[model samples]
Target: MNKYSYKDLPSRRERLFIALRLPAHIQHSLRLSAELVQGKLDFRKWTDHRDYHITLQFLGDTLVSDIGQLRKTLRSAGAGFQPFELRVSGWGTFGLEEAPKVLWRGIEGELGQLNLLQKRIVEATSSLGYKAELRPYSPHITIAKKFLGQVPGNEDKGIFGVLPEQDLSDNSWLIQDFVLYVTQPGQTPMYEVVDAFSFS
Candidate 1:
């Protein structure tokens, strides 16, 4: 007889997702850019540097028992793609201009490959009953959330004009792998990597 048993259920469902982990150098670059506006903008929360990532798909409330099958499917799906290059390009936001919900950094380069890989993952996970979102996929890295600063006007051209452009012209990396991440709601550096799947 073993001390641990599968008969006992896990305490809770995990909030899960698949995403590309950013390289440290790029994270540093994004950090510096955000720091430049930290005093100028008054967002309620800024993303921790360590928690930065570009999400491919969010699997909300995942069952503990489903992880094994998800991992297997992810690995097999991931094996079909080749490594591709990407770079941080610009800035954007989601929600109202006066009070946006998320402030994010944009991505560019090799986007076709990125879209294909995302589509493949969606298809791979669909067999297990994961439904894709109805909205078109728009990839971005969240830098901050819930804008609290005074609203910008036509002359200011919105918050985009306030951000200082970092020298990311030569800053790009090959995305060789993606990871399964679990969200820790109240923790600093909220996301924890559960597994990583490499491309072919």
Candidate 2:
């Protein structure tokens, strides 16, 4: 999706979501990884390092008045959980093979805990009128979008041909908190954290 100015956001309703903010070290590592293949690839937009996160739930175009209640609900929901380890995994794409719409880095480690936290957040927010996504939970940090580069082998070989073989086991970090963020377009870091919910 193209950048939308603050005025251009849907009906001026804040685009909000719940997510786990990656640590600086993890962000730096992912940034370096993206830099390694950026020149070789042809993607229109590479995600800003500050924007790197694992989305728990997307509450799109939300009412400004609802934010306080959302924060309260999130804090209560998050209090039951504890910190869990997670790491940046492999690379992949979303959309079609030849011309994918999104280029992303996958996630690994403590996936069951992550899913449980996500499920709790969804349930907590349901009474506030936010519906859970129909799609199954698949945690990933998006790196780029609008693929225009060519594959090495056959087009059917997909995005893996250009993927770097990097050992990211050391990229693991303890996710201690989740954040509520608002999307602000026409900015270097489009997403801004409004509040954070720390795990007990």
Candidate 3:
């Protein structure tokens, strides 16, 4: 399973990624919480609650031909390890402080264990020819993307000020399994979990 021959794959387009899909109740709670600050910011779109996920490894685009082997590799990667507790908390942005590009909520608890899971996924699958990202993992679930404008200098008047202290410790989940999701590029909330692997 470590190596793959390109010839064995059937060629068809799919953007694939590995992630932990948030449970329905958590997603609902997260959406409600995010709505509070969302009004203070200008975003072109908010991702649907059903689409929320915490990605473990972004596998990027792949042909449908590789999916079968990819699923097997992922299953092997996710074979061991018991479920651990993880919490969703806080909020942040990526890109510039004044004009953010993405708005996302933070994740906490059992981070080292989360990193280990990420590492195993990459190591087990990278040999199949997907380039492993070297960037440090910063796990977050995006609520919205494509910031429309800059935040005012006075942090208190805009999103920075609007954000209140959050503690979603009660909003925690057991990190038990990972899913392989597929989507056609540029489709809205069209993602589908093609396969899943549970930790033993």
* Best-performing candidate as measured by TM-score: 1
Clashing pairs in 3: 10-65
Question: Model 3: how large is the Cα RMSD against the reference?
Answer: 4.5
Residue pairs in steric clash, candidate 2?
none
Model 1 misplaced regions, further than 4 Å: 1-11, 151-157
RMSD of each: 3.6, 4.6, 4.5
Model 1: per-residue Cα lDDT over 51-118, one tens digit each:
99999998898877677789999999999588999999888889986678999989998999999999
Off-target runs (Cα >4 Å) in candidate 2 are 1-12, 151-158, 167-169
Candidate 3 lDDT by residue in tens digits, 155-200: 5575666666784546888988999987645766667888889997
Q: What is the C-alpha lDDT profile of model 2 across 88-194, one tens digit per residue?
A: 88888899877889999999899999999999999999989999999898899999999987634434544677678865647899988899988989998999988
RMSD of 1: 3.6
Count of clashing residue pairs in every prediction? 0, 0, 1
- Model 3 C-alpha lDDT versus the unseen true structure: 0.80
Worst window of 10 by summed lDDT in candidate 1: 1-10
